[model samples]
Target: MSKVSNRTKIAAALVGVLALAGSNLVAADPLADVQKADGQIHADAAASQKKVDKFFDQAQDMLFEYGTVADERESLKAYNDYVATLVADQEASMKAIQDDINGVDKLRQGVVPLMFKMVEALEQFVALDLPFNTQVRKERVENLKNLLSTAEVTLAEKYRLILDAYSIEREYGNFVAVTTGQLNLDGKDVLVDFFNLGRVALYAQSLDQKTGWMYNPETKGWDTMDESHLRELTKGIRIARKQGALDLFALPIPAAETAK
Candidate 1:
């Protein structure tokens, strides 16, 4: 073989080796691609961490605002409860007042007639009684009757007057009274000493102790009393007036209900 041909073959072999090495360098690497993908994932994680930090700060501010509102909410709720209680009490009180007002109208109707009946009963009692202090008692009854008819008098006032009259009649039954007054006997007026004995009996005597009479309820008049009755009746009047010593004396007694 010629030296030139041999040199050409060696050169060709060296060129082929260089070309294979160049192709190997230009080929794709799997490890390098994996590294590039991991770097991209790390960048995404950094951005997400920044967003979480900002959200945590906002959450802390929201919690602080809620705490501040919690204390105010309790105070406002307590004040509202107090107001509700007051409103309930006011409604109940108003209802009670309305009920009282309604009852007053009914009471006035019943009490007014009752007061009139009481006054009439008092006048009848004065007429039936033993005719002592007649003018004063009759005047009281007349005053009560006039008050009942008057528009200026209230029912409560009329009722009080009736009760007072009844009390006076009741007191008259418990004791004796001796009075010097004008006595009408047989259509003639005479000054006499009157003996009132506990709503049971009434005896009248002249100043000289010579003339006397007993009251008769059925006939509504005065009748002449016996001589024996005069001694006991005169002594009773003197004793009642504190002009004589106290002593038990024989006297006629009758049960008469003055208050009734």
Candidate 2:
């Protein structure tokens, strides 16, 4: 094999190993492993590409039906069912694709830079406090659109990459909470950083009948701020800050703050 192809194969092999190992690669050169994984990730990306295209087709078909039909209860329910089914099927595959992407230690290191970009994109939506998270969803669509420009990856693979990044942020979001009240910055108490994970967690809890925030049209903001939202404003937790400031949870905090 050529040098480039050989490197790529080794990288794919690392991804398979990491997938079996999950996140337990302590004491290993994570960056090296990640680089190796990314090499293969791009290669196997072809397999995932087909699934993503099929999903998009199904989603688009449902959306077309939804748009054409009256927005009635039954019609809306049908549309939602279509989406729920699609999401259900894609969730597992997306998870695997993301794990491989993230497990490629190289990719994890780049997450912070993307997080900054994601944060900036997220800020615009959060600021609007749009109902049903219209802004976030819109941003997500746009982000996926932009990821298409990345060379050497299919559009579907790029989408997989972005989704994986969200998962990474969600899985690691609570690390901010762990530092609340325990860590101090500038002698002030830190509230939990409201990012994708916190938003997802709070949203899930609410969906499950637990307490949660509500969009207040009167205030044009999110209301019913719970401990979960404010528990670590000053935790001085570190995040993807090298990429600059990210508007996580609609809050315009700098990447420097995340680095702390």
Candidate 3:
């Protein structure tokens, strides 16, 4: 009919070009891509949040079941099954996190501070309680600090190491050991048998079994115990080291000084 307007011709040409290049400009599966990305973000958030939720769930369950117990076997069974399911779900959620962008860095920012605090607390405990294997303990704390600073070590491994340290420290409270090391006795480095009696006492025995000293935390010095107590100290060490039978014996137990 009538001649088409120039504007209409230009519009038609533009539409043709867009159609030819549309595949390159626009994503073919935009919704699919969005769904995948959103799922990943959600999964990552869920992964971390689920652990907290599970903890609270256990707490609440305990609170609910504390005073109410209609059927012992049924309740116990149900509770155990629920806990198992929660654990499985938590594992699945963690696995579902996106490989490229799982918010682990953000988690480490919060966790690194906690790890530092734990280490500091550990250091203080070692300082106040008893200075046994001190250099070794210091090295362990230093290693943990260095590991935390590195990018290669994962957060989980760091946390596990801290827990292991704590466990070792706790286990120390239950056991005694006889280790020989250098001790500064009266301004002299003496090679002595350190008798660690489960944080209850710390004693140093001379090579000739002639002298014994108890650790004094106040001045960080060693006070020589009475030679009359030598038999008791020897028996105690023998029992602790499993070299002899255990029997009741009176040995020096260092009293922790009250802070002024």
Candidate 3 lands at a TM-score of 0.57
Residue by residue across 1-260, what tens digits does model 1's lDDT show? 99999999999999999999887776656667878989988998998898899899999999998998997899899999999999999999999999999999898888888887878878887887777777899999999988888899777777887898899889988988888988876678899998888777878899888778877776667778778877887888789999999999887543353222
lDDT of 3 by residue, 89-196 (tens): 998877777642467778778888999899889877877766688888888878877877888977889899999999988998888899888988567799988898
- CA deviation > 4 Å runs, candidate 1: 1-87, 254-260
Using all chains and alpha carbons, the TM-scores for the candidates as numbered come to 0.64, 0.20, 0.57
Worst 10 residues of 3 by lDDT: 251-260
Steric clash pairs (candidate 3): none
For model 2, residues 168-245, the per-residue Cα lDDT tens digits are 544544533311111123574334323233332221113222333433344444455465543232221223322334
Name the weakest run of 10 consecutive residues (lDDT summed) in model 1: 251-260
Best by TM-score: 1
* Models, CA RMSD each: 8.0, 50.9, 35.2
lDDT of each: 0.83, 0.52, 0.83
